[model samples]
Target: MPTAASSPKNEITIVGAGIVGLATAFHLLAEGHRVRLVERGGVAEGASFGNAGAFAFSDILPLASPGMLRKAPKWLIDPLGPLTIPPRYLPQITPWLVRFWRASLPDRYRASLTAQGGLMRFAATATQAMVAQADLAGHIRADGNLQLYESEAELAAAQPGWEARAREGIEFEHVRGERLAELQPGLSPRFVAGTFTPHWQTVSDPYHYALALFRAVMARGAGLVHGEVTGVEADSRGVRLRLADGQVLNAGRVVIAGGAWSRPLARSLGDFIPLETERGYNTTLPPGAFDLRRQLTFGGHGFVVTPLSTGIRVGGAVELGGLKAPPNFRRADAMLTKAARFLPGLRTEGGRQWMGFRPSLPDSLPVIGRSTASPAAFYAFGHGHLGLTQSAATGKLIADLVAGRRPPIPLEPFRPDRF
Candidate 1:
């Protein structure tokens, strides 16, 4: 019997209702294509719901860097440190770690920086245009980010990275003493130097921003399907999406934007990507928790304090535990304790803790090109910590491909089978 694929193949289905998937739907809808968003759970309830809501366009540095490699030994030793690997999952994650180490090689790291910077440049433009076109300007905040350093040594150590950002045309000022105090008051005196990016921006709340995008797409005639996609088969006719309970949907083209859960789907389609889950934990305090003037980055400790409309969010750390592990609220507690000490007046009570997976690639670049198995299918996950920051650009690029137009940037760096 014929299914929905028999229809003129006008509708495009995007898997995952997170920011990436939703943004893709938005762009597809704008291109005059019918759109359907399929999700396994509530929209934005994954990493999108709990992230520190920074636009972070200036953050083009890849996580798999020599700097991070140097710090990994100490970080991995602490069970609740910024980076960790659960004992039981060590064997499973070893392969990904080995790839990560390769990516950290000096030459590869430089290439990644160039690729990331290019994507970020496109992302900044794409985000502005999308926000304006979607009428989401009200939800954005232009407050700068203050990245604090503990001592002169730490600041000096980070100078090269700062120079890299400057070369990329990202504006920032190195500040201290009175200037630093004015930018962010109540900061612990222990922080002797800081880099302030005056143009840095953030959303009022990440989940709310996602909600607004969801509303924008829906208002433009986008639809949603609630199901777990278990199988995908793309043929000359179109693509068929299968849910676990045997329900099937058909679309002319599909974008696999399912975040951390996307690897298996890509594998089923014969694209073996080395995707890993960067499990990040965070704690959100109730409103009035602190007089945070702007986002505060304690980069050395692997966290940031974001002032959200809903609350004060404090968290950032990578737990290399796999998808099925139970929540370790201890990570949240540790970040909160550190936050209180740094802010000197933070109210850590009435805070909510969260854990979520960031789908990551070894080279810190997302897979944003055609699937090796099917031209009708595309891969768009693995943005890692920058998923939200890069969502609109991914959307625009993917939409261009679906429309049979040339993408604005080279997609070779983000191809699926690169690993």
Candidate 2:
């Protein structure tokens, strides 16, 4: 059993200043809890800064599905494919890959789907409430997502997943011919079909959205600390966070939302979670880059082109390279080349390329429970690509746990000791 936060005015210290941390701080503050946000870099400076910006409430499927496995082999061969594991990292990644394979089994996949479905449902509701509460509606766009396909075979191959989404009450439309062009003009004739989800929404820009959330937290009396956290220790006295500068701050409780750089902190606290990094790549072009409409997904190719309030951002792929390796910008180049072909009028020049780490678990679910080591410590990391999408829900759930109130959803599927 975990120790209760004890009072409505509990002082909580959260590590990591990304979307997850900001959102967690927002919820805690809503309950009149005092919060101090600690970060090694600027807010939303990591993966949260450059994601596809979709709310993705409809993306309930786990990435470890059989479909992903079928695509992985082909993607692995091509260094710049939608998914790639660096040759040197293969040995280290094998164990995680084995777990991923088991997760893709029919029985396991169904279990994960049920849990993910519940989270997505709660997430959609929680995100709306958060946005409304913070009055950040100006940053949101209701423009739906259009996933493009090149051939009938490709479209046919996607039917099962669509059917699964339908079973979960997600609304979507399958369109071909002129309707495709109407949804997104200037597309190459090669794209024969698409599926549009009308409820999907996006932020004008992910980083700005997070910054808005941070400001909301601050307005409610949250403090911001900038430094690398080297260690976390807890005892009956309280939880203490040690920074690289040899500073220590004690708080009523601590929540770790440290994205891809969180594994070491968790390990030091006695939990051995198999957290890995998916090095995602992208490029942001100038504002007038092809007048991109809503986000466009080239699923078969493994990337997306999104229109942000800042610019037209292009490309995203899973590169299972570790944290230490230098980024291969050619991956960005590859996706850009493909985007130009799909959107005939896309201007590829004058773009800024970026690479960031997305922390992941083999089961494709985040850890959102108290640390098995101590009741005073909690976890809210390993969200992978869905970190931005699920941030608000994770925040609410973590707040519920700290307050000693039963979470709206079961935590069994996201327990810290599950492994």
Candidate 3:
């Protein structure tokens, strides 16, 4: 346990200011708990800000689904593939890769879906409520999303997964041939089919949403500190967060939501969670040239091109390289190249390129509960690609667990010790 008496001032200290951390602060503040949030960088500037902006309730499949392992090798060879494993870093990534491969087994993949789908469903409602409560609904759009395919072959190959979606109660409207073009006229002539998910939604500006959450927490008088949490010390009374700046904050409980940087901090608490980062890239195109009716996904390619309030944004590419590796913005450029092929009229007159790491676990399911070894220490990170979609629900669960209350969603499925 950590002692509140151990600090100069008693407060709950949450490490990392990504969406997850900020969301946790919002929930804790709503419960009238004093909170101290420490961030090494600006909120949402990490992986959260660069996401495709899709709140995909219909996307319940894990990344380790069957048959994906066979495709991984070819993707790694292509510099512009949606998924890539750098040759130099392959040795370091081998173990994680093996674990991920094992997770691709039929039994494990279904289990992951059951866990992810249930959590994401709760996340949908929690996210909506948070936006409304924080008055941040201005940034959100609840209209659905579309995943378009370029060929009949692609559609047929994906039908099994879509069928599984139906069994999981995920509703989808299949659009093919002329019907697909009718829904979105701007699509390329090459598009043959698509799936319309009425439950999918998006945010206009993820950065603004993150800032709103941060401000909401601050308005409640919670301290938002700028520093890195280096270590944690626990005793009979409570937990103490050791900041890099030499300042210490004590809390009756602690939640680690450090995004891609969570693994090391998690280890300090005795949970060596096998967490990794999937660095993703994005690019923004100027307005007039790229006018998409809704967010569009290249089903076979796994990237998305969305028409935004500012401009058209193209993003997606999973790089297994670690967090510190230099960003290869070429990946974003490649995405732009692919986007142009899908939308003939799209043009990029010099756009901003960005890269960020989504904290990922082997099975794509986030680590989202109390540590078995350290009950006082909780984990709410490793949301991977679904951080933006899942943050609010994760925060609510963490808050409920810290207060010794039962979470509306089950926790054991995402327990830190599940590995």
lDDT of 2: 0.90
How much is 64 displaced in model 1, in angstroms? 0.8
Q: lDDT score, residue 40, model 2?
A: 92
Tens-place lDDT digits, model 1, residues 118-150: 999999999999999999999899988999999
Choose the strongest candidate by lDDT. 1
Error of 1 at 137 (Å): 0.7
Distance from true position, residue 132, model 1, in Å?
A: 0.6
Better of 1 and 3 by lDDT: 1
Arranged by TM-score with the best first, the candidates are 1, 2, 3
Give the per-residue Cα lDDT of candidate 1 at 243: 97
lDDT of model number 1: 0.92
Q: TM-score each candidate.
A: 0.98, 0.97, 0.95
Q: How badly does each model clash, as a count of residue pairs?
A: 0, 0, 6
- Residue-level lDDT of model 2, residues 27-134, one tens digit each, is 999988889999998889989999989898888889989999898888888988899988899898888899989999988998898899899999999999999999
CA lDDT of each candidate? 0.92, 0.90, 0.84
| lDDT tens readout by residue for model 3, 42-138 | 8778888767887877788899888687667777678778898778888888899998988999999998988888898898889989988988888
RMSD of 3: 2.4
